[model samples]
Target: MKIIILGAGQVGGTLAENLVGENNDITIVDKDPERLRELQDKYDLRVVNGYASHPRTLEEAGAGDADMLVAVTNSDETNMIACQVAFTLFNTPNRVARIRSPEYLRAKQRLFLSDAVPVDHLIAPEELVTSYIKRLIAYPGALQVVTFAEDKVSLVAVKAYYGGPLVGNALSTLREHMPHIDTRVAAIFRQGQPIRPKGTTVIEADDEVFFVAASGHIRDVMSELQRLEKPYKRIMIVGGGNIGAGLAKQLEIDYSVKLIERNLARAEYLSEKLQNTIVFCGDAADQELLSEENIEQVDVFIAVTNEDESNIMSAMLAKRMGAKKVMVLIQRGAYVDLVQGGNIDIAISPQQATISALLTHVRRGDIVSVSSLRRGAAEAIEAIAHGDSANSKVVGRAIGDIKLPPGTTIGAIVRGESVIIANDRTVIEQNDHVVMFLVDKKYVPDVERLFQPSPFFL
Candidate 1:
């Protein structure tokens, strides 16, 4: 696929890195020559230095025959216009834009038609990050929670703790622990290294365990690896930006929510917009302000301020002040590894969420959803099996018979409304949604080819 990406920032750069190795022709556009040069130096792709929305820039980036146009520049207006320009002047087949403004997103149904913005897909990083945080909040103690197969199945990551029922036992004991619920251990990470799980594999404490099961059975499976946590009730958020305000608005009805904004004007506006949330105008890092708000009684403290340093400091302070859990929104990928598991309970990355969303559209075959895990080292994919035994490699085959790539595991199969946990004897039928985990991303192309029908198939 020949793709033109409009942006040299984090999202654009990361997307280029992912696609360049996947046999796609990637060209990145940006006004900053330095950013373009950096990408060009690091990867085997072309880079165009010009205003992303300009027609001349698109032409230089080879948009005329590009398979897709991805506009992810920082400015919402720029991204929307670039998509329109790509569609009108270049006739690009697929146009994906990263739109941040809520006003534009709220009216996207009517605003993004062919006669309007011409954006085929809209990527809202703020909305994606907010939804990601909401899922984590819904299942306490989960390091990561991503759903697939239209929410019928979920992939959850949690750390195995001491004294848990299945922590020190072999993988085969999971069935004895929970005879009623069916689940599969996708992959295990011990000290940042991937471990292919076997029936005799014993889960050790502090091992990050990724598992897949029916959405309703997620909590039951999580309890086997760690002590189940009490549902969260009191929530405090630092930052009045889109993610913070949106989370507060959505969670206020169910949980006691409070928001702290450094800017007084924005705080007042949020106070009017949100009915149940308490809006405070003060510095989130202020020790006195956190104490005055009874931080010790807060169940969860989330710092989503734009500044990474501020979020890390405030979340650390909250944890030190006796907050049960602290979740911080970190922009830089490097900082995510540094802060998480130290003072912060979870470090949410907008880049990862955006990349995951973009990959869903870029992936080949019948893939419906893609979730990046372990910071892009691993991926969970939901792909619909098409064709039959004569044409497709996966369809009409048993789980153990399929030749999956190294470190790839079939976690579950979603057929119609039923979620079936994957086993060696389970046979994959036509139209079944196969949920898989890849511990190594280099095997993505191999996995994609497995679902593709043979060329001779009618």
Candidate 2:
């Protein structure tokens, strides 16, 4: 696919890297020449340096022949205008714009009609991140939770900790542990290496485990791998920025939420805006402030400040101060890997989450959801299998009969209202939402091709 991307920031740059590897022609447009040069030095893609919303810049970025235009500049106005320009001038088939402001998105339903905005898809990173954090809070022990097939099925990642039922037992014992619920252990990562899960494979402590199950059965399955903590009640957020504020608004009703902001004026604004949350004014990393707030009693401490160092410092402090679970938002890839396994319970990359959401539209098959697992090294995809055996490579075939790429495993199938855990004899029918886990993401294109229906049907 020929794709044009606006902005050379984190989201756009990461998308370029991901799509270029999938054999797509990617062209990036940005105002920062240095950032453009950096991307040009690393990946095989075209880059145009100028105001992204300008028509000349879009034309230089090959918008005329582009199959898709992704507008993700920092400015929401620039992104929206770029999509409109691409639609009016170039007639790009697909236009995806990343809009951050809530006001713009709230008005999108009424404002974006026909060619007014011309945005085929609107992605909000802040909204996506807020939803991501909410899921973690809702499910006490899961490191990652992703829904698929209209929320009928879920793919979850967790750490196997000591004192859990299945932590020291073989994978086959899961059925013995939970006789009624059906679940499949899709993949396991032991000491940072991918281990193909089998019935006989043993789950050691600290092993990162991935599993698929019906949405209702997720909590039961998760309890087997880790000692589930009590549902979160006392929550403390270290930043009053967009994500922190959004999360507090969602969690305030169900939990005891407290928000801390460094700026006094910003804290006052947040206090005025929030109804149930307690707003504090101080540095998040300050010992006095945390101690006074009773940080030791915090069930979950989330640091979402823009500065990576501040977030790391505050999260570690919270953990040492007896916070049960500490999650920090880190944008840099290296920082995420460094702190995740240590004191921090979870390290979230907003860019990775954003890319996963964007890839749902970029994918060729009838994909319903795409989740980046293990920091983008692996992916969990839910795609609809269309057509009959003669017309589709996946439909009307047994699970073992399909030619899946290496490091790929069929986890489950959502057929109509039923959820089926995939086995060798499990047969796939037309229109089934097949959930597959790929340990190696380079095989994504191959998997997408396998789910495509015959050209005659199109």
Candidate 3:
């Protein structure tokens, strides 16, 4: 696909890097020469520097022949204008804009009601990252949230302790303990490639385990496997940035959030901005000071410090001090490898998450909304059904009859308001909103055909 990306900042730069996987003909446009230089140095792509709103600028950037134009500038106004120009002047097939002001996402339904600008998609990275924080709190053990088709199923990650019972046991053994919980252990990665764990494969201690389960039975599976008691009540956050503030505000309702910052001005700012959480001004790295605040009692310790090393060290310290779950946001790629199968529960990057979400929507035009889960190996796809699907060869045919590919399942058939888990007998009715759990990317079109009846097939 011929793609044009406006804004070569942190998010856009990251997008350009990830776009290499698709090997799409990509052109990045921005006003900063240094950032463009960095982008050029890093990725195999063309870079243009100028105002995206300018017609000649976009034309020079080859937006005219572009299949997609993505406006990911810091300013939402810039993104909105760039997308409009791409549509009206360049006639791009797809246009996406990233809006920072979160309220726009909330009022998107009414704001974009007229469709004045043909912005096909809108991304809010902060909102996306905040949702991650929410998911972590909701399920303390799971580092990543991978929701499957119809939101019926989810894949959660949990780190097993050194002397846990599940260790030295095959994941299949989980079924015997929790028979009622209908879940599967999809893939386990301990020493390299993803292993479809069998009855004989012994799970080692300190292994990061990824488990798949029906959404309803998620809790049951977690309780059965982990067995570690007590819900995480008190939490300590070691940053006062937007991510920290957003996470604090979102999680403060259920859990007691104590936000510690070194800057007095920033601390006061947080105190005023956030209502429920207690904002304290002090060096969070100070061991004595942290101890005075009873950091040892903190059930969940989150290190979202601006510096990657600080966050890592803080989280490690929290773990040493007996914090149940520790999560850190490590932005740099090199450092990410350091935490792989390491102590910290999760090491997330805001930039990576944002760029990833944008790229996900860029690839998934047919899927109404898409979230690439399990580190982009699997996709949670929501697509609308057409009449052709109901009259296809697969229709009235049991799933077993058709060569249903591995790791692919019909998550739910959303007829209306209700979410229905699909069974072999369940028919794909026309105009149904079909949600699918797709593992192989090549079979997306085939999966789409399964929902939409094709006249040729019947």
Candidate 4:
């Protein structure tokens, strides 16, 4: 695939790195020469240094022969105008833009028409990050939660603790513990190393475990591997930025919500805007402010400030101050593993969330969804099997007979309204959605190839 990306910021840079690995002819356009040079020196891709929305810049980046155009520059106007220019001048088949403002998003239908701005897809990092946090709050104790087949099946990651039922036991004991619930252990991570799960594989303490089960059984399966947290009620957010404000808006009705902003004017604005949330004017890292607000009684403490260092420090302090669970919104990938392994319960990378959402459209075949797991080292993909037995490699074949890559597991299959846990003898059929887990992402291409229909169908 030939791809051109606008902006050298976090989202565009990360997307370029991911797409370059797939053997795509990637070109990134940005205003900063230093950023462009950094990307060009690191990856095997072209970089254009100029105003991203300019026609000359797009032409220099090979927009004429590009298969897709991704405009994710910092400015919403620039991103939208770049898409319109690509559609009108280059006629690029696909155009994806990153839009942040809610006001612009309200006119999505009007702006994205071919006769208008012509954006085929809009990636909202703040919206995606807010929803991701809400999912974690909804399902306590989960490090990450990804749904497949319209929420029929879920893949959840949890850290193993000493008190869990199956923490020190082999994977096979899960059935003995609860024979009624059908679930599959997708992958286990021990000290950052991927472990292919089997009946004999034992889950050790501190290991990150990923499992697939019916959406209703997600909490039940999580309790088997780690002590389940009580449903959160009191939620404290340490920023009034877009992500923090958006999350509070969604969770305030269900839970007692409080938002702390360092700026008094911003706090006043948030107070006026929020109906059920309590807005406070204070530094989130200040111990006196946290203590006065009864931080120890808060069930969940989330730090979503723009500064990574501030968010990390505030979250760690909250955890120490007796907040049940602490989540930090971090931008740098270097800080994700470092913070997640420590006091912070979850360290979310905004770029990773944006990249995963963008990948859903970039993936080939009939793939419906793709989620980056373990900080992009692993992935869970949901793909639909098309064509018949003669035209597809996966359809009408038992899972055991299919040529699946090593370290890849077919966790579940969703047929119409029913969700089925995968087994050795389970046979795939046309139009069935297959949810797969890839522990080793090096084999992602192989797994993708297996789901593609033969040339006869094409």
Candidate 5:
């Protein structure tokens, strides 16, 4: 579980802290001695101050023994080159690079099977951020869309709006209406954390919900609830850089897209590459220009400019001006929570999104505790509750009998072919898939034992 991270910038720093805190042996590499020193001071790991793409640098940082090498420097080329060095020179098993360019993204088809660009994963933050906003509009009431444990299971987040379909209905009552669904309400997050939802746990307006189901059930659940029924046609994206271009390409097949950028040269260049998208050359913050372009009638407005404040302000203006959905792409984690909680429908962080995607497959030993904290887009959590095995102390007990943690909500249990949502009297069957909310990684063992009475891991 040794991970070497290149670039101590926003994304790299966030990844290092989160992964290291999760008990992985992490080493951060950067040219900045001060950044490396600062990370070393804060966390318990090795920090190497050198160019990660150099052989001597990898030797100094011990990348030869690293389980994975992460190159996420500000420079996309640097990050890619760093990954190449990690793979070629250090012979690292896994190599991940942070690519912010649209050309590389579009070249993914060519690179997918090519060893020249033999990266395990390439993270495009702008694409991820814009897609989040697209998902919100595509599925109106659903609060989240998360792929869990290898995309076999999808976790959908929904908000119970006033007069919403399931308002004031019992979880069981709601399920009776929709038959043949291979999913469950799992755990409900009301008043916060996981609760033994009773018949009286009425689905109120704005009550955030997480539903775990098979991937195919996504459209079914959203369609039944009158959310995410119809796909979008027109999307207006502000900013013509990597994010806007990436979105334009990703969504062009289904939607008529427009991209606005202040830089005429870039806009003209983007226009040449994109066929379905119209590149507009104007200041995105300009109201007159937006109106001239019919921004109000658009289905989704994505503010993905490099400036954090501009993105937030533009998202607000887009929402106020009558765009159906607004999304802001931000690198800083601080603004994500504030904006999402305040008014922004979707807030996507490049660094966090990349980390969440990476962690979905990177589990060491018996630990299964990587989740999308979502800073606030959709809620996707992964946890292993106690089973009948030696590692799990509790089995065949009702959820009500377990000593649960604060801010944690149990969502679903994997029992054979079925993933069951819990009621107070719902018993924890043996070898169940117990999913919980807000469960911290540090106390995972303690939390695991709480479900089943056990002495300790022997």
Candidate 6:
């Protein structure tokens, strides 16, 4: 596939890196020559330096025959216009635009038609990050939670603590612990290294374990790995930006929410916009303000300010001052590795969330959903089985009979409304949504090929 990406920022660069190694032709466009030169130096792809929304720029980026056009520049207007230009001038088959403004997204249904804006898909990083945080708040102790098959099934990541019943036991003992709940251990990470889970594999303390189960059974499975935390009640957010304000608006109805903003005008605006949340005008790093708000009684502290340094410092201060849990939003990849598991319980990355949303469109085969995990080292995919026994590799095969790539495991199969936990004897039928996990991302192509239906299928 030939893809022209109209941005050279974090998301554009990361998307190019992911696609370049997957036998696809990737070209990135940006106005900054330095940014283009950096991407050209790091990867084996072409880069065009020009204003991304201009017709001349798209022509230079080979948009005439490109398979897809992805417009993710920082400006929402630029991205929308670029997608329109790609469709109107070049007739690109697929057009994806990253739209961050809520006003545009709210009207997207009527605004993004082929005859209107011509955007095939819209990726909203703020909305994605807000939804991600909401899931974390729903499941108190989960490091990550992503749903598939229309919310019938969920894949959750949690740390195995020492006191948990299944922490020191072999994987085979999980059945004995919960005979009624059916779950599959997708993969495990011990000290930042991937561990292929097996029957005899014992989960040690501090191991990051990823597991899949029916949505109702997720809490039961999480209880086995760590002491189930009490449901969150009080939430404190330290930002007035899109993610923070959006999260406050969504969570205020259910939980007691407080928001702190350094800018007085924004704080006053949020105070009026949010009905249940208490908005304060002060710096998050101010110890006096945190104390005044009774930070020690807060159940969860989330720092989502635009500045990475401010978020890290405020979250650390909250943790030290006795917040039960702290989550920080980090933009730089290096800071995510540095602060996670130290003072912050979870590190949220907008780049990863945006990329995951874009990957659903970029991936081959009939993949419906894709979640990048462990900072892009791993991926959880939901692919639909098509064709019949003769034309499809996976349609008529049992879980153990199909040839899966290394480090890949079939975790669950969603057949209509029923969620079936995958076992060796479970046979896949046509139209089943097969959910799988890959510990290594290099095997993504192999997985895609395994699920692809032959072209001759009637």
Total clashes, candidate 4? 0
lDDT per residue as tens, model 4, 87-201: 8998889999999999888788787787877989889999999989999999999999999999899999999998778877999999998899999999998988989899999
lDDT of 3: 0.72
Best by lDDT: 6
lDDT of 3 at 1: 72
Expressed as tens digits, the lDDT of each residue in 1-458 for candidate 3 is 78899988777876776565455789999999998998898788999989977898999999889988888887898888888888888888888888877567777876643258577887777777878777767775665665645466666767666666677777668768777555656456565445545667777865656666667766676665565546789989989887788889888888899999878999999999898999999876678777888877888888887799889888887777667777888777567757845678777777666755675566633456555554445555666655444466454555446555565665456666555545556765545655555555446555555555555765
TM-score winner, 2 or 3: 2
Itemize residue pairs with steric clashes in candidate 6: none
* lDDT score of residue 401 within candidate 1: 93
State the lDDT at 383 in candidate 5.
Answer: 53
Q: In candidate 6, how many Å is residue 422 off?
A: 0.4
Error of 2 at 308 (Å): 1.1
TM-score of 2: 0.97
TM-score of each: 0.99, 0.97, 0.81, 0.98, 0.78, 0.99
Task: Note the Cα lDDT for every prediction shown.
Answer: 0.93, 0.91, 0.72, 0.91, 0.69, 0.94
Score residue 192 of candidate 2 by CA lDDT: 92
Q: For candidate 2, write residues 1-458 as lDDT tens digits.
A: 99999998988998998899888999999889999999999999998889988899888888898999999989999998998888898888899999899888779887676547788998998899999999999899999999999889999999998887887789999999999998999999999999999999999999999999999999889888888778999999989989999999999989999999998999999999999999999998888888999999999999999999999999999899889999999989889899997899999999999999999999988988899888999999999998897788877789888789999999999989999999989999998989999999999999998898876532
lDDT of 6 by residue, 76-154 (tens): 9999999989899999999999999989989999999999999999999999999999999999999999999989999
User: Between the candidate structures 1 and 5, which one is better when assessed by TM-score?
Assistant: 1
lDDT by residue for model 5 (1-458), tens: 78888888877787776667666788888999988888888888898888878888888877889888888888888877777777777788888877877678878768733278668877776666666555565555565666544455667777666665677777666567777775566445554444545546766666666666676677776554434434666788888877677778777877888888889899999999998888889877778877887877887788878899988887787777777777778878887767785678777777677776555445442335455654522224555455464544446567776666554556566566665655557777554556665534455334544644355633
The regions of model 4 sitting more than 4 angstroms off are 456-458
Residue 75 miss distance in model 5 (angstroms): 2.6
Query: Which consecutive 10 residues in model 2 have the weakest lDDT in total?
Result: 110-119
